[model samples]
Target: MDVFRSMQIMVRAIELGNLSAAARELGVTQPTVSKIIAALERDLAVRLIERTTTKFTPTEAGQRFYERAKQILEEYADARADACGLSAQVAGLLRVNAPLGLGEMHLHRITQCFVRLHPKVEVELVLNDRFVDLVEEGVDLAIRLGGALPASAVARDLATSERFFVASPDYLAQHGAIEHIDDLQRHEFIRFAWLESGATVEVAGPDGSRHIALRGRYSINSALSIRQSVCDGWGIAMTPAWLVQDLLDDGTLVRILPRWQAAAQTLRLVYPSRRYQPMRARAFMDYLESEIEAVPGLTTSRPRC
Candidate 1:
């Protein structure tokens, strides 16, 4: 039995919860994955998985082995990368996760440039609207838009994002323009549902930083949806200025209460702690930070140190 390959396959199967999915991720056939798992189980003389009609559960022994297997696989990858001079070259698969709107608008160009600079590097961009567990999801890095991150991860500020209260020209013409925060209560608001708690947002405006309890005619978790609704004259929304810059410039959307600014959210480049960050991972983070710094509104232009 190829013990290492079997271990890798089993670990991936446990993570993905099925053989077919694991096979697809590993670039192998389902039968091959099944055979490998079966062989490994027979050799070990322990049933690693409990398969039922509806689900696959790892046995206690399976869980223990999987934990060690992941470490072994990661170490092996690190050693291989080091041997190939990847420590000196930015070359490998970089798995990155970011908000869908930011990924489509901002990250796409940066990723293209990074790939151009390092032709050997491959980037897997997962544009998810929901917050993902980087360690559990096997992501190398994530672009987070908010304040400081949890202590479990290391973060660097990529930019300071300014929030704007905006509405479409048609919506303002119909509902009349809002000159103050209190005016929001008189109109329909579109809220972005928090991913962790599915709860609607009660945002604070700049004046007195008073929390405004908003009522949305429609609520969704997607930033894109909120932008679209505002564009369609559904309602006024509080969104990041970076997202609506083009719309504001082109007269598609107009900013209300332009003199008042809401709390700024920091754009962060977050990754697992250094202990867990491999050379390839660090390289990707470095590339991302450099690229983001070059973008307008992220930071003031300065000579590279």
Candidate 2:
């Protein structure tokens, strides 16, 4: 039996949660995939996967083996690339994930430029506002806003996103000028759906951070929707500067509470913790880091250690 080939099949099967899907991806028949997996189990004298009619999951031992097998496959790929004198070549499918707002506003353009530089590389950009399980979702890399890092992956700080309290010029004209912090309570706040922190909005300034009670007539999960709602003269929103920079510049939106801003959020790139990452992934990360300055309202400077 080809041990290496079997390992590849098993790894892909576990990742995809279906032997047939793995077979399709690896260009083999489903029966071939099942036969190989059965052979592996018999050889090891252990059941590697716990499968039901609708569910498939790796056992504890299988999980350990799967992790090591992935590392081995990466190492083998790297060795093959070097031996074939193709160490510098970047050719493969790279799955990238990012939030809906950032993905639509900047990541699409960045990916366009990246593919132009490396024509051999193909990128699948997945955009959503919900939390993503990187390994389970088969994502190669992810660009995420502020959150604690999971132990399964390594994170690289990319940039800082400064947020602001913004509203349409028409809304401000109709609601009267917001001359002080206390004035915010009288206006409607287009809140994010995920934020269940009551009606309070947090602001940071020279005096320190504080939360002030606010009213909201509307709420949505998407950042793009929030931006649109604000632009359509719905109400005020505390949104990321990157999301509304163009609107502010074009006089479609105006920044409120300039002296006190929402706490800045860090943009990070996260990927599985493999010792040997593919040349394609490394090159993509480096390229994205270098292009940080191109994203509006995001600063390249990280905080001093």
Candidate 3:
């Protein structure tokens, strides 16, 4: 068996999630893909994947191999590009993952400009609220928002987003104004469910470093859904200012406790730590950092140590 070719096939199979899909991607038949994986497993003396009739899932070893294979492939590609004097050209597919709301609101314009600047680079953006494993997902970069990131990834702060407690005028009219954090318990709150443990909203007021215990009548994982629910007067919500800045300016949404500020969230451009960062990735990050700084009220200052 050609070990390198089989390894490539195995990587494709894991990424595509099925032999048929891998076959299509590799321009081969399903049996050919299966045979390649079978040979690869035999050569490695380990079961790389667990397969059922309807689905295929990688084993822990398989996941590790997949990540390593991606790094190896990226290094090989970079070396080949350098040999061919294509390193400066920046031509290839660049995969990015970002939160759905932010991607829709900001990334599209950045992507347009990026493509215009590097005409040869093809971009694929996956927008989801879920945090994805960059290496396993084969993502080139991820745009993340919130507090401190995992130490495993290299992060660069792109912008700072202030958090605000907002509710529609209609909701406030019915529920009365929430003048204090204690009042939040009496009111129905729309919570962003994905803000998991270790996350706290720091509100400045009479009680310094006050962290409110969040209780919600309705919980959603999507920022877009949370915004819509808040706009429709479902309940008071704490969200990034950028998501509701227009509504606040237009009198559709009212900011509660404007005097008691909530901790700000930072937008970060993150990628897996590697020995070598590709020129395309570096250039894209540089462009994004520049563009994001130009936005009003958003600053790119380094976060306090």
Candidate 4:
């Protein structure tokens, strides 16, 4: 038995929470993954995984071993990279995760260009709107859009984002224009269901700041859907500048509060904290930075220290 291969399989299975997912990631049959895991358990003489009909979980011992195994794998990757002169070459599978709207807009292009530059590298992009744990999901990195992140997360700021309230021209024409912040309450609102904000929204305008308590009939989780609704004249919605810039220019959506500013967000690249880093992941991040800087809205023209 190849102990190294089995360890890799065992670690993937635990991280993915299923044998089939691990197999798919590793490009092997499900039975092959199961067989390797069984051999690993037999050799270790411990029950590492607790399987059930609904789900699979790692035992306490399994959790401890999994953490250590991940460390070992990282260290091995670094050492092998240096030994094989792979420090200059990026050749490996790179799995990336990001929000659906952002991914659809630019991440595919980013990955495509990176692959073109490094033909030896394989890329996987998973666009999801829900929160994902990088370690548990076996993700190499994630593109996150938020104001602040967890204290323990390792992240790099890629750009600054500004949010704006927008609506279709026909909707605003029919519903009456919002002359002041107080007028927002009178208009129909489209709310993002996953957003933690309460029913009320506080806005900062040219004159001052005020709060508007909204009673939106439409609530959705997807930014794409919200943009569509706003374009279709459903209601006024708020979104980042990057996601709706095209719509704004093409006259599909119009900015509602030009003087009133919404919350700003930071575009970030987040990863699980670790002592050693993978060469491929690092290379890809560098490539991404270069690619993002060229895009007009993704990043600013200012230099970083």
Candidate 5:
């Protein structure tokens, strides 16, 4: 039995929760995977996995072995990379995750440019509004828009983006004008379905900061949907500047309570670990930092020495 190959197979099977998925990912047959696991169990004289009709789970010993095997695989890969001078090479599959709206507006184009620059690099861009586990999902890097992050994640602040309370010109014309922060109480507020700042918003102005309770008839989960709703003259919304900069420039959307603005949001590049970062991931981060300056409302937040 090839112990190294068995370790690799077992680790993948556990991570994916089944042998079939592991076989598909590793490009091996299901029977081959089963045989390897059986061989491993026979060699160790212990049952490594427990199976049921629904799923497969690791035994107590199997769980411990899986953890150690995963570490061994990672260390082996790192060692091989270093020995082969692969650390400096940018040829590999890179999985990236980003918020849906931001990914559609920016990261898609950014990824295109990156792949074009380094033809050997293959990128998979996953766009979603939900939280992701970087290691479990096999994501190399994630572009996060808010400050809150998982404790296990290592983040590098990418930029700071301004947020604004905005409405369409037609909406303003129909609903009248907002002169004071309290005046917002009388107008419709388009609620963004977010974990942070759900029912209330804090804005800063010359008079200082005020926390206002949001009252709205319509609530949407997507940034693009909120922008469209506000653009259609539904209500006013507090939005990240990057999402509406173009509309603002074209007069499709106008900033309300122009003197008052919400707290700036920090964009972050998040990864699973600080140790053993691949060359491709580092290259992508550097490329994004270089291009961030040209994006409106986004200012670099790189720490200065």
Candidate 6:
């Protein structure tokens, strides 16, 4: 028998002055209440109540037990309230995981603001290109850039990343500007090795859309490395605009096809789904959503060719 439940039913029966009323309050049948009362009496080896037809009254000993049981239930409620409050409070170490380049480029700024807004939270950001098991690694949150989610992954998309065809002015000056989409084939291409099968860039013209394969002379795995290579006059590459926004503004890098771009990336805030997320993680996720919009070229529509 559930001791607490038995005690609660006895207490409610005494207060309501009727077994039927107590059963109604508890959302249980009258017979169920009678069974609990009987079990509780057997467990205590004492008759707890005097019953007559539709009315009930607690015995002297039952009065004492009822008072004590009420206190126990109140204490339990208080403890639960405290536990829920602590679970929702933002005051603990928040371990976060994210891809290297995106973390360094954008997330750090938003996190900096989030910590300032919530000083009690201590953040540990682990930046890596490889995927980490959120449960095994004990990560509160992860920001994944343009990647497929696992079968069991739970994620909230925060923003879309725009990929721009960027190259340094020096390289364009040397090789000459690409006058048309076909001109991209005549030039050596800098590729991000992680792209794998997606070496082709889909472009839209007055006629329709087609994929232009980047004939790679150089390939890099890191977004930062790819941006560096493009800036260093290695070759043209499709890079996330936020990663090279300053370069684009300063003309160190120029957007090759203003009208055309590769597919936009879906940036997601990922986490393991089991229980309610910690307050710090939830707070940071909300903060990042608002701050990410400020990144240049993130919402800017493509220009006409």
RMSD of each: 4.0, 2.6, 3.9, 3.2, 3.1, 16.7
Q: Each candidate: what lDDT?
A: 0.78, 0.87, 0.81, 0.82, 0.85, 0.78
Error of 5 at 179 (Å): 1.7
lDDT for predicted candidate 1 compared with the true structure: 0.78
> How would you encode candidate 6's per-residue C-alpha lDDT over 190-257 as one tens digit per residue?
87786666678776655478789878768878889988888899999877777888888887898887
Question: Which pairs in model 6 have colliding backbones?
Answer: none
Candidate 5 per-residue C-alpha lDDT over 1-305 given as tens digits, one digit per residue, 9 for 90 to 100: 89999999998898789899999999999999999999999999999999898979899889878866766776677678789987665776788999998888888998899899988889999999877988656677899988578887899888888998999989888889888888888888888776577768999998999899878888878988988998899989999999899899998998888899988888888997646666778899999888776677677755544
Ranking by TM-score: 2, 5, 4, 3, 1, 6
> Which residue segments of model 4 deviate by more than 4 Å?
1-5, 15-46, 52-56, 301-305
Give the range where candidate 3 is weakest over 10 consecutive residues by summed lDDT.
296-305
Across residues 1-305, which tens digit of lDDT does each residue of candidate 1 receive? Answer: 88988998998898788889999999999999989988999999998888888988788888777766876777778778778776576665778889898888889888888788887778889998666776556677888888457676788777776786889999999988787767878888887876442323334544445556667758888888888999999998888877787788899999887766667768888886646565566777777777776554355233578
lDDT winner: 2
Q: In terms of TM-score, which candidate is strongest?
A: 2
Q: Residue by residue across 167-264, what tens digits does model 2's lDDT show?
A: 98899888899978889898888988867685687898767888988899789898999999999989999888788888888889999889989889
Looking at candidate 1, the ten consecutive residues that score lowest on lDDT are 195-204
Candidate 1 off by > 4 Å: 12-47, 53-68, 84-86, 147-152, 194-207, 294-305
Task: Give lDDT tens digits, candidate 3, residues 83-156.
Answer: 99887777667888988988787787888899899988888889998778887677889999875565668887
Worst 10 residues of 2 by lDDT: 296-305
Off by over 4 Å in 6: 1-88, 300-305
Candidate 3 RMSD to the correct structure = 3.9
Which pairs clash inside model 4? none
TM agreement with the true structure for every prediction: 0.77, 0.92, 0.81, 0.85, 0.86, 0.68
Q: After the best TM-score superposition of candidate 6, give how far the Cα of residue 44 lies from its true spot, in angstroms.
A: 30
